[model samples]
Target chain A: MKLFSVEKPGLYTTYQDLGRVGYLKYGVPASGALDRFALQVGNILVGNERGAAGLEVTMQGPELLAEETFVMAVTGGDLSPMINGRRIPLWKSVLIKKGQVLEFGQPRQGVRAYLTVSGGFHAKKYMGSRSVYEPAGLGRKLEKGDELVGEPRQQKAGTGLFFTEIPDYDRDVDVRVVKGPHHEQISDKVVSDFFAMTHDVSPQSNRMGYRLQSDLATNHEANVISDGVPLGGIQLPGNGQPIILLADRQTTGGYTRIGTVIGPDLPLVAQLPPGGKIRFKEVSVEEAQEAAKQEEQKLRIWERFTR
Target chain B: MKITFYPLGEAAVKCCFHEDISTALTYNIQAFCKKLVHQKHVGISEWVPAYDSVAVYYDPWKLSYEEITNVLVPIANEMDAHEKKTKTVITIPTVYGSDYGPDLENLAAANKLSTKKVINLHTKRHYLINMIGFLPGFPYLSGLDERIAMPRLESPRQSVPAGSVGIAESQTGIYPLDSPGGWNIIGRTPLKLFDAEKEEPFLFEQGDYLQFTAISEDEYKQIQREIEKGTYKLERREESE
Candidate 1:
């Protein structure tokens, strides 16, 4: 049976798994969920694997019409999802029958949301991932009248699961970052200025990168021979603008990267809306790894709760 | 050669070989990359190799930054000891002049040479793939003939078509996908640089050598037809050292 049909594609809705892994050498970006924690928890609530393919709804969530009896869950942003015009709860799995329309209004919190079914999205896996990396022609964003198929599910337990602590998307966030591979290449004065700078997310920011508004200049010519870019790489182009490379960023670039946003704090950056204010906090790599460990511990706790 | 390890992020470590770009440094990177892949570690996830450095991404939950560096240091030390493998040489079929070659005249004029001379110069050298980047399957090739070198356009094209063979300064490459680029387009290739359906999506790898074979417009059409029919086999040969 058809899982759902897109009534409205919303701002942007695409299928994302953990990301396309092991393909960076070939220039494939690790295009995956922006808010991976939210996606994982959504999958956990729906009794799916952590890396299952799910819909990554942007500022506005897609309006979907279910065509079969299935269990589904919505996580990440509070997009004000409603089933047949009645408001539905976030972070909980719910049952829907045929003809029930799942409509998502304006987001109440965060920028992106995840929608997961008991079984993952039935999509083609390119290079071992279902992520929609448009440049590589792997998959595409959801459009009106587009039909999506899901794997046949037996419907296990774990419905109505709600996390005690939900992320506050509206608050200003401190994006923790580590000294980069090319950090030393930058001037000490510029590094200090970078730390002191208060930046706002550009309206042009997308899956590829978050262009931060900062007129900060580096000491040297911001050109490298071209090197592999890590996710969350804050690359300072010759234009003196900082572009935080994200999920759909090109695998490599010629611009000199000042630093990399810590993996644990990437979600904080991802949750911010356009014009969202963020401050870069330079921390030791050890501290960043410690934060990551704590975050992983939190996820593990959630994993236990969901099961 | 000193190998310095730096924290790329919370979960990955980057090892830099040297600042300069050369065949020797690239070979060292390739050799180190070979070792990392062959002797895979439990926590190691992926290795992203570029012109002068390789970033090793790992599972933070499984391994710490210190552990990752510890794992890489020895392998990096032994990289020079590893015997170099024969390189793979792939031939790219390109149709030069007219629409197939958008900036052929511009490139030739910039170098004060005839269009045919530019094409001949471009096809003469065996260009090395320093890295695959900027776009998927986009090869950053070196060894462009000095006479035909051209600077990037002052204003980049909003969108360059896929399979466009372009030259910028001392470098030449093909656009694997339609993307905004600043390179001077000299010709077009019929081969798909990247195919999502293929088991191995990319047409070339880092350290692989590329040779562009000039073809006619009719040949380009025929090759395109064969490619679409899934019958065209890319011409490749093992480079004997």
Candidate 2:
């Protein structure tokens, strides 16, 4: 099976999965989907396994040509779709016919969209991943006039695939964090003020990190060696703006982490676009993990709830 | 080689050494990383290796942070014991001037010497790999001659091409990919520091020793053509000392 060449590529379109994990030792950034939950939803809709590589089109999307037949699904954000210039709603499974043109027009709401194919695209997987790290030019962002060849679907669903209920994804999400190892070094007043303050996501934020600007006070050691930084670690620079680590962040960092946005809440952090405002509440490590499991359970229940 | 355990998150623990980067410390990280990857520990997914530290991501249900840290101390000490046996030396070939090496003359003049002198001093020293980071396969090499210390460019260029030999902050490194960089370019090497197409994408790994040798522009072109033709072979450096 084959996917058509891109007639018009919009914004940033790239291949992504859960990410390139276990390669930080050689300084490879773990490049993956910004919103893993959204990506999973898209994959699940098409009956693809979670963590399978797919198209992560941000806000504006590419105009694609479909060369062969396959069950495709789009999940994430509120972006209107068009098949051969006809309007189609998002978050629902759509059967793409052979030689038809598919495109995502202007984003009416969310900043990201996830599109998943049946068997996943046939891309060269490096280090057990097909996620492209654009900076490294390994698996690059899908560019204009690029022909995409997809792998054949492995599962034969004798009954054509379709999902009845669209997922209920809340745009407004609150993320919780755990106080970091260096949290105490930063004043208690700052910690208290941080929880009290609400921050707006700066335009400066991207896959590498999320930079938030707020009235919250900040502090950092001028001379510090780099250390292994966990995902969602909130580091406050000397300038007072807080930077949260993401999938493509460096293996180690020199900044001071005020808190670590727990694992479960990391998906919430990923969905935030520039100018998004949010606040963080502190929780214990044990509580963080428990919340993660609970959050996972809630996600599983989302499908059942709609059904 | 000995490291203290610190909890990074519920699923991972960081093993950090005391301040300072060196060969011995890098070796310790290598040995520990080797062990962690091979062991069938419950919940331990993978360990990320670095110059003076290792970030071990594990499953909380299988192994606690305390358990991984407790197992790491003895292995860290053991890596130091076998450092001599695992020590490896690698040499890189470089060409001095022309279109390939754009900033060679400037770096040579800044050091109050001819371009030849700069190349001689750079190639003469046997440098140790401190760590690999900043970019894929980009190594932070220590033991540079203090005389050639040069600060990074006042304003970094938007893209420094691959295999660009650069110096900054009394240290030297090669740009593995075309990225926004400020390092002072001394010369360019035709060697592929990074190649995603290969079995081992990175030609050089952490903790390995490196030596540079001077080559001609013709030789550079020859290597480039051969590399494109898939017949280029780089000479290996024998490791004893």
Top DockQ model: 1
Please write out the lDDT profile of model 2 over residues A128-200, one tens digit for every residue: 7999887877778888888887774644322222444343334455778778657757778888888887788
Query: Candidate 2 residues B145-241, lDDT tens each?
Result: 9877788889999988898888897998888888888988877888888887777777766667888888888888898999888898766665665
lDDT (C-alpha, whole model) for all candidates: 0.85, 0.75
Error of 2 at A103 (Å): 3.5
Error of 1 at A190 (Å): 2.6
lDDT of 1 at A120: 84
TM-score of chain A of each: 0.94, 0.88
Q: Judge the docking of candidate 1 as incorrect, acceptable, medium or high.
A: high
Candidate 1 structure quality by residue, lDDT tens digits, B127-218? 98888877788888889888988889999999988999998888899998888989999899999999888877777788889999999999
Docking class of 2: acceptable
Please give the distance, in angstroms, between residue A181's alpha carbon in candidate 2 and its true position after superposition: 4.3
Superposed Cα deviation of residue A90, candidate 2 (Å): 4.8
- Model 1 ranges with Cα > 4 A deviation: A156-163, A304-307
Clashing pairs in 2: B43-B59
I-RMSD for candidate 2: 2.2
